[model samples]
Target: MSVKLLVTTVLLLLPYVHTFSVEKRVSKLLSWSKSENEAPTILGWCEERRLQDATELQVTVSCGDSEPLEVSIPIPTDENTLARTLWPSSLAAAILLRLPASEQLVKDRHILELGCGLGLAGIVTSSSAKSCCLTDHDEEIIQLLKNQNIPNIDVSYLEWRDEDRPNDIPPSDLVIGADIAYYFYLLRPLIDTTKAMLRPDNSAFMVVGQANRESQWDLYHNVRDGCYNQLTDEREAPWNGETRMLLYQLQMFKWQVDDDIALENQELDGTIPIAVMIHTSPGLENFAFTTFDHIATKNDKEGIMMSF
Candidate 1:
C-alpha cells in the first residue's frame, strides 16, 4: 500500500489497543450538592475514538447521583499515562447550549481556557464562539492538545503562578475556563489574566460549580470589588444532544447574589438543566431570557457604583 494507506491503517488500529487496557465505559453517579466534609468525586474511564483503534483516550469525570449520570469525555490514549479532573468539566457544554441563539456568538472573540487539561472546554466553546485558545502548565497536556483536532483551538504552555503572561495567547473579548478553583494557588493570576482581557463594552465569564465558586469569587472581588462578577441561573431546557456543554453571553458590571439562596442540582432524566449567564454590564437592562421558563434577567442593586 501507499504511505497514506499505511498511515491510515496504523491510525485505525491505535485507538482499539489503547482502549482495551482500561474499562470500556465509566459508570458512576457523582454529586455536586457538596459541603466542607464532601468534595465531588471523579470516576475515570476510557472512550474509544471511532476512527482510531489504538488511539482511544482515557476520560475521568464526576458522576452525579440521579440515574447515574455518566458521560465520557475525549482523552489521550498514548504514553500509557493517567487522567485526572473534578468532572470532565461538562459545565462549558452545559453553559454553551444555554446561551441565546438569536444573540449569535462572536466569531472573532478571543477566548481562553484555564486548566484546559484535555482542551474539552475550549474545544467545545469554539463550536459556539469564534475562536478558542487553551493554556495549561503541563507540557504533556500541551502536547496532547496538539494531537487532537477539537474544532477551533489554539494551544500554548502556561503556568498559573508564573510571573509572566502567556505569550502564546492574545487578548480577547472573553476569557473562558471551567473548574479553575480546584486549586487555591491558581486563583489570583488566573483572575488577573481575565481582568486584563476584560473589554469595556463586552464582558467575560467563567463556568464553575458551587464547589469552586467561592474561591473564584474571592479572587475576582479582590481586584475591583464589583468590577468582577458572577452569575448562576438554572432551569430545565431542551437540547439536540450536541453534548451537554454550555456557553454564555455576558458582561460583568451588573451581577448580583445573596445569602441563604435556594440551590438546585443537575436533572439526569435525559434532559439537561441549563444556566445562561452573560458577563455583561448591568445584566442586559431589563433583558428577556427566553429559554429558562421565559424568565427575565432579574437585576440586583448589590453592585458597586459604576459597576455597569
Candidate 2:
C-alpha cells in the first residue's frame, strides 16, 4: 500500500488515470483476441529498465487453465518509453498467474485477494466462486478493476497495513493470494488483516512462485506455528518448464518456535530473515491451516494435481 494516498494526490501526473484489471489494460496495450471463453489474463502491460538497459515484457494469462495466451507490447527499443519504463511494475502479471484453480477444496467459497495489481484472480474468483473481492491501495487500479467488472468482482481501495477497514474483504470466509510477500512493511499488516477478516471456519490458499525461496520461507514461518497446523502436503512443481525451487525451506521450522532467527539493523533489513508469530484461537479443529509444497511439473497440456 506504499502507493497509498501518494498516487491519489498526484492523480493528474499519473499516466494511468482510470482503474481496471491489468488484463484489460494489457489487452489494450497488446490488442490480444478478446474471446468470450478465455481464462483470466495476468499480464496486461509492462515496461522496465534495469542497469540502464530497457526491457519490455507482455504476457497473456490463461490462469488455472494455463494456456499460453499471446500478448503484444512495444519493444523497449522505443525512444519514447525510455523514461517511463524505468521502473514499471510487473505485480499485475504475477497476481494473475498466481490465482488457484477450482477443486473440491475451494469451490463456491468466499475468497479475498490482496495487492490485486490488476484484479486478475479477483475477477476469476468473482466469476467462478460464490463471491470475490479485489483490493489495492492505488485508486487508478481500483478504478480499473471496477470498470472491468460487469456485474461481479468487488474491487476496492484497501491498504492491508492500515488499521482502518475498507469494507470489501470483510466477509471473507477464505483467503487466496499470490506474490504478496515482497517487503517487510507490507507483510505484517497483511497478516494482521488476514487475521481480522478470515472467518474461524475458513482456510487460506496461497501460491508462491519459484523465484524467491528464502523470502517465501520467511513468510511461511511467520504464520504457520501455533496459529495453523503445518501439514505436509506432497511437493508441487512449477509451470513454464522450470523447476519449482525448494522455495519454502526457511519455513520448515514454521511448526516449531523459530528461536534462531535474528533481526538485522535498518540498513540491511530486506536481506535479513524474519520469524513468523502465530497466535492460536479457540476453534482450532473447526479450521485447518497449512502450506502445500506444490512441485508442479508440466508438459504441453494439463496442469498438476498429483493426489487422487
Candidate 3:
C-alpha cells in the first residue's frame, strides 16, 4: 500500500481501535471481579494516614531583591501522595521568580495555577499577583490549601476532564502549572483547560518541569500546533546530575493581518481567506506540510482560501 493510503487507513481505524481497547479492559476487570465474587479494591488507601501525619515545611522564596517570603506547605507522608511533592513545585517557583520584572508577568495579574498540589508556586506568586487561584483535582489537596487561609489566594478543585470546572474559573491573565504533563493522555485536556481559563488575548500560560519524559516534548509540540504562540525563548536550568529543568511561556495566538487586504481579496475572489499558521522545528517541516495539505484538500470545494 502507498504510504498516504496506509496513513489514512490507520487514522480512520484509530477511534474504533481505541474504543475496543477500552471495552476490553473494562470486560477484563468485570471478569476478575466476578471470579473473585467481590468488588475490586485499590491497595494502599492513604487518605486517613496522610491527614493524620502530614507535617508542615516552610519554603522561603525571593524575587528580584525583594524580601524573602516564607510559605508553609503540608508534606504528605503517604507513598501514594505524589501530588504533594515539592521538587517541581520548587523548580516552577524559581522560574516564575526569574521572569523579568520589566515584563511584569505576574505582578498585578490574575494568576491561576493548575494541578497546584501543594500550592507552592501559586502561594509564592500570590504576593505579587493581584489575585491567585490554586487548583487541584484531589479533594484532600484542596482542603489542605483551604486550611492555609492565605490572603488574596483561592483554593478550588479543578480536573481538566471536568468541563464544568472551567466555567467556574474566571478568565485569568496568566496560568501556571508544574509537573502536570507527566502523562501522555493528559496533554490535550490540560491544554484545553488552560485555554478555557485564559483570556482570548494578552494572556499567557507558563509551565515548568524536569525534562525526564517524552510527554514534556509532546506538550511543547501540542502547544505549538494549537492556538498558543511561544512568548519567550525556551528556558532551561540544571536540576540534578543528568536531568534538566525546562520552562515554556506561551500566549494565545493573535492575528495581525491587514483588514483592507483581506477584504479586497475576498471581494475579488468571492471567497474568505483562512490563515493556517504552523510553528515547527527543524525536523517537523514534513508534519507541517502534511497538516497544511490535509486542510487544503478537505476545504477544496468550500469557498475558502487556505493560506499557510
Candidate 4:
C-alpha cells in the first residue's frame, strides 16, 4: 500500500480504535458485583447516547430492598463543561442506594441534593428519604428535573451564588451533592448553601470523581478549612473507565439553626409570657427568688412566671 493510503487509513480508524478501547475498559470496570442477596449490589447496563460521544448508563441499585431502583444517567462527552451531566452524580446515586439497612438515616429524614444535575442522585435518594428535594441554580436543569415523575421528590431552584438561604424549601436532615466542586469560585458558596439547607445537628455529604484534578483539591482544602469536621473516602469508579474519586462527608461545627432561632426570638414581641423556672436547693431559694425578681424588674414584664 502507498504511504499516503496507509496514513489516511490509520487516521480514519483512530476514532474506532479509541471507541473500542473505551468500551473494553468500561466493560472490565463495570463487571457485575456480587448479588444483593449476599451484599450491596449496583447492577448496571449501558447504551450509546445520541448526538454525543457518550453513553447512558442505567442501574438497578439496591438498598436492602426487594426491588432495586432503576436510574438513568447520561455521561458527559466533555468533562470541562458544566453544561453536561457528569459521572460522579451517578456514583453518588449508587452510594446512596447501597446504604446498609442498619443505617436508617434516610428513612423518615428530609434530604436535599445540591447541584443536582439531571436529578439522578436526588431522585434515587427520594426512595429512602421522607422527602427529597433536587436543586440546582440553572432554570433549564430545574425544568428538566421537574418533567420526571419521581415520587416524594420535588424540584427547586437553589443558587449557591446567593449568600442567603433559599426560600420555601424546608430544612433537611441530610444534604448531598455529586461532582459539585469543580471550580474555585463555587467553593464558599457551596458550603454556605449546604449550611443554610441542612437542619440543626446534621452535616452534608458530597462525592467528587476525578480526584487528581487540581480544582477538586482546591475545593477540598477550602471545605476542610470551612467545615468543623470533614471525612473523605477514595474508591474506583467505572463511568469513563477505571476512575478514582473522593467522597467527602462534612459536618458543620455549630448548627446555623441556633442563629436562626436567635433571630426569630429577637423578632418576637414581648406580648407572650416569659417564664423563669429554677429548682433550687432549700438554702438557695432566697437567692433564686432574688434573681427572678431582678430579671422581672429589668424586663418590666407583668406575665413573668416563676416555677420551683
Candidate 5:
C-alpha cells in the first residue's frame, strides 16, 4: 500500500482499536469540534514524507450552552518507547474530564496543566476556562503542543525541576495533572511546581490522579504535610481493567490555618445550603462550593472556608 493510504488506514482504525479509552474519544471529540468551527485544524507531520502510524489527536471541551472548543494535536512519529506515546492513560483521562464536565468548576477559571503528556486535560478545559496553559518538561512535548492550533490556550515549556521558574508562565486559578506521581522522587518537584503556578489565594484548586500504586500513596501524605488541603478522594477502574485509580481534589492556600475551619463550620446555621453553591461562582455574594464548605458567622467579615 502507498504510505499515504497506509497512514490514513491506521488513523481510521485507531478509534475502533481504542474505543473504550476515554482519551481517544476526547481526542476525536476535539477533532470533530474543530472541524465544526471556522476552519479545521491540522496535526501531525504533514510534511511530504509521512511516517507510518504518525497519528493526530483531538480534544473537545464544553461548558453550559456554549459551543464546545476543539483542539487538533500531533503525536510524534519517531518515539516507539513506552514513555513516549500520544495515548492517554486512564488517570489522565479522568483528570481531564473531571472538572471540564462541571460547568461551575471550570467555567471562567484560568487553568494550567503541568506535565501534560498529550495535553488532553488542558485542551479539554480550554473551551471552558477563561485562559489555559498546557506545559511539559520535555522539549519534544512542547513542540507537539505548539503544533496544535488550540484556541484560548498558551502552550509552553515548564520544567518542574527547574530551580529558577520561568517568568513567562502566569498564575492560574486551577492546576491539574494525570498520572504524574509515577515515581517517589518526583513528589517534591511536582508539589513545588503546583505551589508556584497556583494563585496562592484560597480560590485555586489542583486536581490530580494516579494509578493505584502503593508507592504513589506517599504523594498524599506529602501534599497534606505541605501547603495543600485534600478535598475529594475518589476511585475508579481503568479502561484496560487494571487496578482502581485514585483521583484527588486538593485546595491550595497561602496562609496556614491554625484551626480546622472545615471541621468547625460543618454545622453552621447561617451557612447557605449546598443547592446554592452548585450554581454560584466564587468571590461572589452567592455561595460557591470549593473543596470545602463556606459559612458566614457574626463579626466575621469573610465567610469561613471548609474543605470536604
Candidate 6:
C-alpha cells in the first residue's frame, strides 16, 4: 500500500508542479518584456523634456505703430544652426515693415516668407498683409510655426531646391527673407525661387541680411546679374552696435514695346533694331536698352517706358 500509493501521488502532483513552474517563467518573461518596452518610453520622455528646454526661449519684436509681437524661438545650437534662433536681420526686416513705403508694398497683399526659421518677420508682416505664408524646409521648424497658430498665416514646407513650389503658396505681391542667404550655393536658388514666387507686375522682393557677410555681397551680385532691378537703395539698420543690417527692395524688370515701333525700326534700318526705354520711378533713374541680340545694358532702371 505504501509504494503504490506514493507512486500515484507523485505522478498526480508532478503535472501541477510543471504547470506552476511554466506560469512562473512566463510571468518573468512578461515582466522583462514590459521593462524593455518602458525603457524606450522613458528615454523618449527625457528627449521630449530636453527639446522643451531647448525651445523655451521667447523673443519680443516691436515694429513701428503696431503692437509688439511675442514669438517662441528655439535656442540656437551647433546642431540647429540658423533654423532655430531669431537673427538680428529678422528684427531689421520687421522694423522695415514699419516704414510707410514698406507698408504700401505689403498692405492688402499676399506675402511669402522664405526660410522662416523662427517666423519673426513673417509674424510681424502678417499683421499688415492680407495673407502670409511662412515656409521652411525643416519639418521641425514647420511644426514650430504651426504651434504658433498665428492668424492670417499658413505654414508650409519649401525647399530651395524643389523644382515645383507648394500649391498652397499663391503668387505673392511681396516676398521676404531674413538672414537666409548665408550659403553661396543657395543664393541662385533663392533668387530663382523669389522670382518664381513674385507677381510678374507690381511685385517686389525684400531681403534683409547682415551687410558685412560675404554671402550678402554674393546675393547683391547675383541679384544684379539676374533679371531683377533694385527699386530702393540699400537701407541700413544698425544692430548690436557692431553689426549693420541691409534691406533691399527689388522689382523684376518688365519690358513692354509697341509693335509699331519695332516694325518701323525694322523697315527703316533693314536690321535688328535697338530699343531704349527710360524709367522714371522714385529712387531709380536709369535706362534699360536692349540691342538686337536682346542684350540689356547694365544701367539700373526702375520701370522702363519706351516709344518711337
Residues 1-308, candidate 3, lDDT per residue (tens digit)?
A: 99999999999999776543310000000001212355432110000111223366555543335455566777655558766666433333443443344135567878888888887768777877889999988888788778878998998888898767745566887687777777878876886687678664455566654333456555655665333323334432211111112222111111222233331132221111112212222322232111112222222323322121
Question: How would you order the candidates by TM-score, starting with the best?
Answer: 3, 6, 5, 4, 1, 2
Instruction: Encode model 5's per-residue lDDT on 1-308: one tens digit a residue.
Output: 99999999999999876543322221111111111253322111100111235467443443324454455666765575332543223223423344323445468888877778777667766766788888887777678678766788788888788878877777776676655666767766876677677664423343343223333444554543332323324332211111111222221122212234342233322211111101111342232222222232222212223221
Each model's lDDT: 0.43, 0.40, 0.51, 0.46, 0.47, 0.52
lDDT of 1 by residue, 126-238 (tens): 65567778777767767767766556778888766566876657667555565565444665566556656555444455444222233534433343233322322333131
Question: Clashing residue pairs in candidate 5, if any?
Answer: 27-58, 30-59, 292-306, 292-307
- Candidate 4 wrongly placed segments (more than 4 Å): 1-59, 62-66, 72-83, 101-103, 227-308
Prediction-by-prediction clash tally: 34, 15, 0, 0, 4, 0
Candidate 4 similarity to native, TM-score = 0.51
Ranking of all predicted structures according to lDDT, beginning with the best and ending with the worst:
6, 3, 5, 4, 1, 2
Q: Which 10-residue span in candidate 2 carries the lowest summed lDDT?
A: 247-256
- For candidate 1, the per-residue lDDT at 172 reads 70
lDDT of candidate 5 vs native? 0.47
Compose the digit string of candidate 4's lDDT tens values, residues 1-308: 99999999999999886664422101001211123354212223212122225455344444333455566555444455463543533443444344553134466678788887766667666766789888887676676556656679888887887756567788876566666765656665775676566654432344333333445544444443333322233331211111112222111121122223432233321111112111111222232111112222222222223221
List runs of model 5 lying over 4 Å from the truth.
1-52, 59-71, 80-83, 86-101, 226-308
Q: What is candidate 6's local distance difference test score?
A: 0.52
Positional deviation of residue 15's Cα in model 6 after best superposition, in angstroms:
60
Task: Report the lDDT tens digits of candidate 2 across residue range 1-308.
Answer: 57877777688655442321121121111111223374322223222112223233343444333444333222324345221221111322232323353322246767777766544445444544677787767665566446554355677788776778876455665565545565545555766677677665434435332232334444554554222222334332211111122111111111112223332211221111111112223332222111322222122002212111
User: Which runs in model 1 stand beyond 4 Å of their true positions?
Assistant: 1-88, 91-107, 149-151, 211-213, 216-278, 281-290, 293-308
Question: Relative to the unseen true structure, what is the C-alpha lDDT of residue 7 in candidate 6, on a scale of 0 to 100?
Answer: 98
- Give the higher-TM-score candidate: 1 or 5: 5
